[model samples]
Target: MSEKILNLYLVIDNGIIEEFRACSYEVAGSDEEKISFLKKNAANDFLSSFKFDPPVSNSGKKMKYKQFSRLEKQGKQFLLFEEIFQKFQVPDSPLICLTPVVDGEILSSN
Candidate 1:
């Protein structure tokens, strides 16, 4: 059986997307989680210069390592709302993020 996974994908146009993924899969689902996941990953050089819209939240409740996931890749092709031209940017501001909350399976050891 395939395991459910939450994939956080960031794209950079370099002809080849030099693989820069989680240093540790222990990352959780809360914003309280350090986004430095990027800053600390190998893509830091290309990502360091751009500014993201809507100040991110590094506050409130926190989850333990490997406790939460959000890409919603539950063996499906689509999940929510209006058509978009991009896979990364929101169609508009996520001021309320009416989008669904996609909590995937917890990290498990078999």
Candidate 2:
């Protein structure tokens, strides 16, 4: 049987991409476990500068980490993340995209 797989993508300005892969077999069975796996296995450089938060409008509001996992699972776009990338001057303004890949398919980037 083919196990579920997750691919984490960090897209930067200048069209540079960094990818990290994790298979269900290697990670725990729970959603939280999967997130932990990605966190632990993600690149140090990515993690060092990574920021998890909603957009500025939603600032001061707390978004649950589980929501991020859900977005990944559903292959939904994260507008706030895009804004964050823009705020940090990730190169191409709003072109810095981050998305999750399931199996061999890439989820959409909002």
Candidate 3:
């Protein structure tokens, strides 16, 4: 058998969503404070579409590269959370919060 992770992540700038690629995000996790932060900036539907589709570990993480490629119709490397975080980390920027992410799903099999 094989293991497929259904988890996904997002890049939250302050509270605003970077993009509404819900089809590009598959939800499940993110911090409550961050979620609350996002609530202040984004619409509720945007949050729900989290049933959209997208990140980083060998842990319970997912891949934005594949979904992003599929959604944006392009083949490029998925930006790591660290790189994305740096852009929004000017001290003036509130915070760059990510749900949680891995490079891809399907970690391993037996």
Top model by lDDT, which number?
Answer: 2
* Model 3 Cα lDDT, one tens digit per residue, 1-110: 11111122454333322332221222234444444444343333333534332243478455444454464455233343334333323222223222322232212111
Rank ordering of all candidates by lDDT, starting from the highest: 2, 3, 1
* Off by more than 4 A, model 1: 1-27, 42-85, 89-110
Q: What is the TM-score of each candidate against the true structure?
A: 0.19, 0.29, 0.22
TM-score of 1: 0.19
Q: What lDDT tens digits, residue by residue, belong to model 1 across residues 42-75?
A: 3323333222222122773332212212323452
Per-residue error at 69 for model 2, in Å? 1.9
Error of 2 at 56 (Å): 8.4
lDDT (C-alpha) at residue 2 in model 3: 17
lDDT head-to-head 1 vs 2, winner? 2
List, residue by residue over 56-83, the lDDT tens digit for candidate 2. 2245544344554566688664443454
Where does the lowest 10-residue lDDT sum fall in candidate 2?
Answer: 16-25
Query: Relative to the true structure, how large is the alpha-carbon lDDT of every model?
Result: 0.26, 0.39, 0.33
- Candidate 2 global CA lDDT score: 0.39
Candidate 2 clashes between residue pairs 3 or more apart in a chain or in different chains: none
Q: Residue 104's C-alpha lDDT in candidate 3? A: 24
- The alpha-carbon lDDT assigned to residue 57 of candidate 3 equals 45
